[model samples]
Target: MAKALIKYALTALLLCTGLAGAQAQESGSSAARKAVPKIQDGWLDVRAGEGQGRLPIHVSRDWSQAQPAVRRALIVVHGITRDDLLAGERAAAKVPSAADDAIIITPQFLIAEDVAAHQLPELTLRWGVDDWKAGFKAQAPAPLSAYAVMDAIFARLLDRQLFPNLQSIVLAGHSAGGQYLQRYALFGQGSALVDQAGVRLRYVVANPSSYAYANDLRPLAAGGFAAADASQCERVDRWPYSLSANLPAYARKPLDPAALMRRYLAHDVIYLLGEEDKDPHHPQLDKSCAGEAQGDSRLQRGRYYFAYAAQFPRDAAFKQRLFIVPGVAHNSTRMFGSSCGLAALFDEGRCTTEVAAP
Candidate 1:
């Protein structure tokens, strides 16, 4: 009887051990599934700046383990309401695996509320919005200065050693995000990543509502009311008039229209506009700054801006790459997918001869 009891006890112990091992294996698999996908080939989260905001940095390759033959990085900036992860995911989905050789970095900025709650007052005062002081006080602070946030992200990228073969850094932005990049590329000056890495930076302005131009508002040769010259007038002011007229005086403070034009002309910037986006009847068409300038229409102001830039000799080379994708609107996903063909242009290749008319 004693021998039989000992034998049963040993059998129960063996069963318990097997169950425990199975449970452990299941737990391990679950943990692996929960992990965030890496940025390039690996995604990890890092504090982008001093704020509570955490940016998900995705890497296509492990730069530490092995150096990639093509050392290129693309910095994608999200629009006003979106985050970096979504932007990166969208870009990754559209780009082919062959292009995966490049490292992609998507840095998220603090939300509007965070920014308004903490920094709005200071920004308002700095911009001399004393008249709107009471209104500003009621508003929240901004997350970070557009420039400061970008600088922090760039610093983090340099520290990561993720892109050992990093040669060129393409700054791509859409809509309001494009507006942010527009200002940053022009005024942010140079950073350590740019200087130390010998990074050649280029701007990809995709369907921005408005851009900071170095040119003044010039009236068409014929009055804006004439039918024969309607096309030229149509090109003159693509945004809604009300919003354009109501622009905060501070927004126009710099007043270097010609200089802004010259700067754009000299830069290697590409403007990607959607062809079907010329909807004057859209709900938001007449609202806000861009819409208000367009006589409340959703006409293609970005295209006009590209054409205007081409009129100048400095922008001749850039004018060749201006493109309008069919069957797309103010949608970033569609625009990115349509413009994927231009990926080669982003490489160390020469510009194509075909030019879209201004």
Candidate 2:
């Protein structure tokens, strides 16, 4: 009987020990997920207020030097993960032709936490993680809007001496990055610089959680859309969701909704939507009342925005198009690496253009 009791005690102790170990491992993983990401090495110096600020970036070529052979430039923005290096590498790989004649650049927009974690220099520009994606003002180095950093990057690319033969520029992003590009498409002033430089500019937006509607319209459940009821969702038309209010300093200018709509519809923008990105419960999916007002999922929101924009009065040269890529989800790799992605980014493959059903 004593031996039996000893054996039972041993078994209980063993079980407790195992449970403790498992809990410890889970705790470690949770800490790791919350840990700050490492900062990138390469930097681009730009004007921040009266002084200069530095931004991290990964470039396929030495953009500082003249690359006469370069005819196209692709700028791939990282999503919420801010994995700029990997994003740049994957983007360059998607276009094999980029090896010889095109340059790929990926810019990293770090947040305050990243700087504090890495003991970064004071001149390093940092923003609120979410605000940066929305073109909001950076928190450090200066109150410069994140979009201004983009403007500086565009100015650098337009240097006639560096890329003498540069004929086109493509700005591509996925997920949160897509949100950035979408809002930028509506309010960003970089296109004017690219236009003045006589370089054709295009935007590739994929799988953004939500879109910035030009007006107050929101998707309805049964079919079509109706202007959002302000009493039900007061913040529905706010900036980054729509052009109604709280526009970032970089994007805030005197303009009416109708004029903004005209500018947006005239721009050449392509959307890449994963057919399988319909999970309404995806953790990263925006489920706020404002977000829900758009649609239930990324796929639905994208289609609704595309169709909504189409209803606006556009010029004969309306340039926005949507491509729904089959068998992809909220993944940047699959969304940007698919045939539709390839065609949209590099004009290399075929993409089935999607039109809103009548």
In TM-score terms, which candidate is top? 2
- The parts of candidate 2 lying over 4 Å away from their true place are 1-36, 48-51, 353-358
- Cα lDDT of model 1 by residue, 113-188, tens digit: 3334443223321111111210111121323233554565566445534445666767777655565565555445
User: Per-prediction TM-score, please?
Assistant: 0.57, 0.87
Instruction: Please give me the total number of clashing residue pairs in predicted model 1.
Output: 38
Across residues 222-327, which tens digit of lDDT does each residue of candidate 2 receive?
5566666555455567777778888887765786767787888888899889999999777667665567667778999898888888777766566688899998
Give lDDT: candidate 2, residue 163.
88
